[model samples]
Target chain A: MERTTFNALDPNSNVGCGRGSGVEQGAEETIFTEQASDDHVIIKDSCDVTVTTTDIQAAVNLQVAIQLAIALVLSVSIADGSQAQKIQQDLLQRISTKQLIRQKTYIENSRGIEVTMTDAEASVSIQLLLQVLLALVAKLDVL
Target chain B: MNESDQLANKLGELLLGDVLERNGFTPSSKRPLTPEQKQQIRTVLENLQVETERFLQHSQRTIRRESKPNH
Candidate 1:
């Protein structure tokens, strides 16, 4: 009878290539090192201001539109007695609510970003709103 | 906060103050203004006040012109 014995040092042995081994260690080291260097610090001196004139312009325009609509409604209601009081009250409440909303939005927007305004544009919008308000008030007075 | 920031803050407070005053905002209101917040309000109010004056003047002119008799 001939006896065959298993040798651990065989080149083709599967025992040495078991589940967890040093080969994976090299790969893990490389991966860990790569990951460690991936996160880079970015230093910034000044942040970019993102708020545009367009935003303010659009908001002002919308306000003007609302004012015009209110004026129109006031004009129609004031022509009739009972409706005048109701319209005036409704308009006042609506304006107060809108002003509150505007204040909130303005603060929120201004908090993070820098807003640049030109004197000309600001003056224009102010003029527009004042005119609309005056017109509406005049109509209300007549009523 | 640098000097520029401080100045800006002051301007903002002034504007906010104007707005609050114009809108009948009281310190006892639900939305109380902090010192910093007041500065912001003041800035907005200042800007708005300028615009409001301009608008009122323009409107007055328009009304006057409209009320004029046709030659």
Candidate 2:
């Protein structure tokens, strides 16, 4: 088995061509060379070539980092069911109290005020809360 | 038993303390809570208590299962 690796770090185009090296028993070792040009093209094994817009490894590493960060945050937050429950309860209570006040006002007045929370608003609030919690945790060296 | 579990336990303690501090529940802290903040803390505590109960129940179930004899 023969393995080859190529790495390029330039905006300009380049091409790698592999040629068979003659050896014993009619076997040949492949030679790989890069051709610099305005258009990048990599030819490997004539039929098994991959074209990438950006560095795939770097992209994969970035994706993994994002996933790990998200997972860490979620796991830390939700690890203790009690804490999660507490937070949920607190949020619900606050929201309910607000709802109650609105209800009372509507009952006292003829005009009705709708207290609706958009998904974006809820998401932002949750994110903010998480960030605050994470910051606190970081300060304590918990993470 | 695992390192991650140990870390999680420590993290839990820290997180609880953080929550309390943010809510001005510190012992030495002399800040008065506004009505809204008080209400919020109460709600959070209530939820936490419920979650604790649920967790205890689940753990108990797991212990029982582990102790059960094979049928």
Candidate 3:
């Protein structure tokens, strides 16, 4: 949709003009071009001028799309920071409460003068004591 | 009797038998532990319990400390 005008007299201009392309030599020529559909264009005149045009609408759209994507990413990251912090705090509080309860129970059981052990607790304790005694017996025999 | 009491009674018998056998005394099936032996066994089990609890507490503390943010 963008239009570009090239002056044939400018040596730096990319417009190409051959001597047989109907452009008069030594006279400044103005060429109006629409959006270029291909990568290469050959314009010829008597002055042997050369020119090129690029699609501006596509480039502008690409820039705008990139900026919008960056803004969206920035906003999401900002929102997630506080949300992640809150979730971590909540999980830590729950774990702390459970640990406190377990510690209290453990202390109470350990401190009792005549502690009564559950079946599973008694089994584990007996197994541990057997292992210790067996190790002692083995050591005493070795000596 | 609770499971721990039964376990303790069984362990006491086993220990008494072992000690007697080591001292060249005949082991008896019905022999009960002396008051002194019972006290010693209780002390050992209590010490083991305390050590286990301390170790667990230390592990939990280490985990909690490491789980926290450094900053």
Worst 10 residues of 1 chain B by lDDT: B61-70
- Error of model 1, residue A82, in angstroms: 6.4
Tens digit of lDDT per residue, candidate 3, span B2-38?
6754665566445534543443432121134456644
Q: CAPRI band of model 2?
A: incorrect
Candidate 2 residue lDDT tens string, A8-117: 11112123222232112322324332333222222222222222222223323333332333233323434454544454344333322111101111111111111221
Output the lDDT of residue B65, model 3: 8
- In lDDT terms, how accurate is model 3? 0.32
Instruction: Compose the digit string of candidate 1's lDDT tens values, residues B1-71.
Output: 55643554454344434433454433333222246644543454345446544443342210000111112
iRMS, model 1 (angstroms): 23.3
lDDT tens digits, residue span A1-143, model 1: 98533222222322232223213221111101112221121212112223322234444554565455444434442334344445445444533323212211121100112333222433343434444344443323322
Model 2 bad stretches (over 4 Å): A1-118, B1-19, B22-71
TM-score, candidate 1, first chain: 0.28
Kindly list the per-residue Cα lDDT of model 3 for residues A1-143, writing each as its tens digit. Answer: 88543444333444333344343344344333333333333233223322212222322333233233222222232234443244323322321211110111111100001112122322333333433333332322211
Share of the reference A-B contacts seen in candidate 3: 0.00
List each candidate's DockQ score.
0.03, 0.03, 0.01
The true-versus-predicted C-alpha distance at residue A140 of model 1, in Å, is 18
Model 1's TM-score against the true structure: 0.22
**Per-prediction TM-score, please?**
0.22, 0.18, 0.18
The list of candidate 1 runs beyond 4 A from truth reads A1-54, A98-143, B1-71
Task: Please give the CA lDDT of all the candidate structures.
Answer: 0.35, 0.31, 0.32
Top lDDT model: 1
